[model samples]
Target: MTPSLLEALHWSTMDISGAEYRGKEVPLLVVPTRYLLKLDTTMISYCDMQRVLFEEEKSAYNQAMQQNICDGKIHPLTSIHHTSTYNSLCKLMEYCLSPAVTTLQDRLKENELRLSMLQEEAKQLEADTQNMRNGSPRRLMNHGAGGKSSPTAQSRHPFSNQGSPRSPSGGSRRRAC
Candidate 1:
């Protein structure tokens, strides 16, 4: 109160009159989280999906084996074969799940570059407007002509007859108020 930079009281300041904190017991509600999660109970799990894909792959291989009676046919149940199948499945899953993050990042970069370019243009236009609002160097130089101003662009400059009378009625100031 006396300009001493005193610290303000916080919630834990129990020494003040009737200032103790009170606890409340509120009933908790079980809010539905369905909106928070993008989950469907009907969707199969990843392991189930992989099992189904493996069954399909095996059926396709069996059909191919029936069609081709070559004795040098490679076995389908090898560990290397399973690895390649899993790798292909994972690649498919990744391709399906990817959200085009790189494309969005590229677009964001382009927009930022455009924004900076527009800001620079705005700055240049602001400077030009300021220069035009005040008297420009060209206008100032043209005002050095004698009292007889030509009826051209130079004579129409804002500072053309600045040193002459400023009023229509007969005030003697150099500039209009």
Candidate 2:
């Protein structure tokens, strides 16, 4: 039955070159040739297609309008009055902050003045330290001396007591044998 259908459909051939179908050569007969013309069933009329395109365009336009409305709602500062108010608030903030800036500037000036005074004091202390290092004969005196001595005299008489009383024991005495 399927071979008859294939023969009817012109799909079966009589030329069998292989032994597998040697005894099964189809008889040559007048088979009608059929050509299938492609029919586009999904195509609509031109007017209907244009109507669908118009609907899509309309939906896109509506969506854009809705987006613009939403944007306007999200930022209500789209008006000139709101912009002017925002600028005024900024100016007010600057005005409120000016006093703090002035106070900080005054404090900075005072601190600079104090720093200069302290630097002058430090310079004076350094000068005083240098004078003490260079200016006193008594500053170089030895531990037990009462009078100030020059460097040469102190060097020449290194062990002189300069009027300190001697001990009665004379420091230490050895016994005579």
Candidate 3:
């Protein structure tokens, strides 16, 4: 029996001495609680009784239930309710989650479309950038006379080549009063 059921039945614990058929001593727990003898017989062993009462394998069941909940096969609170209430809650959850699932699917599709559009825009921008890089030198060369002009021809003062030794005034001049 489950521990809750045992608790509800108000069973008390007592250790009783017993002997095996081979004349060996053994210990037994006497639970002074009314139970259907046939149904309770299977749980009479010490280990089985301890397992049921002390909850040593509690995490196993809890982990299984958690996995079921995550897989959407069972509701988290289903164990706490009767079969009828649990069925009703399951139906209610289905009803509530249906629209939420639909909304999520719609949003996913919208995001995919937006992402594809952005990707296409990025590709176009990359192509434009490549074309700009390829054509820039030719454009710069053509900006002056068909790419034939010397570099100094594009300077702000083409006639004032200042690197020569000749000064602009040809000779030093005295200041006049």
TM-score of each: 0.26, 0.33, 0.32
- The lDDT ranking, best first, is 1, 2, 3
Worst 10 residues of 2 by lDDT: 35-44
Model 1 scores worst on lDDT over the 10 consecutive residues at 38-47
Mind sharing the TM-score for model 2? 0.33
C-alpha lDDT (0 to 100) for residue 77 of candidate 2: 46
Model 1, 32-98: lDDT tens digits are 7876554333233544665677677767655655655457664555545655765686677556535
Residue 127 miss distance in model 1 (angstroms) = 0.7
**Candidate 1 lDDT score at position 113:** 100
The number of clashing residue pairs in each candidate reads 0, 0, 0
Off by over 4 Å in 3: 1-81, 137-177
What is candidate 3's TM-score against the reference?
0.32
The 0-to-1 C-alpha lDDT of every candidate, in the order given, reads 0.58, 0.55, 0.54
Candidate 3, position 50, lDDT: 48
Which tens-of-lDDT digit does each residue in 1-177 have in candidate 3? Answer: 998988756643322234335667799888755653542354245335444543434554466556666556687466554445545655665575566567667878999999997786667557546656878854633434343444434353354333324434675653332
**Model 2 bad stretches (over 4 Å):** 1-79, 137-177
In model 3, the Cα lDDT at residue 109 comes to 100
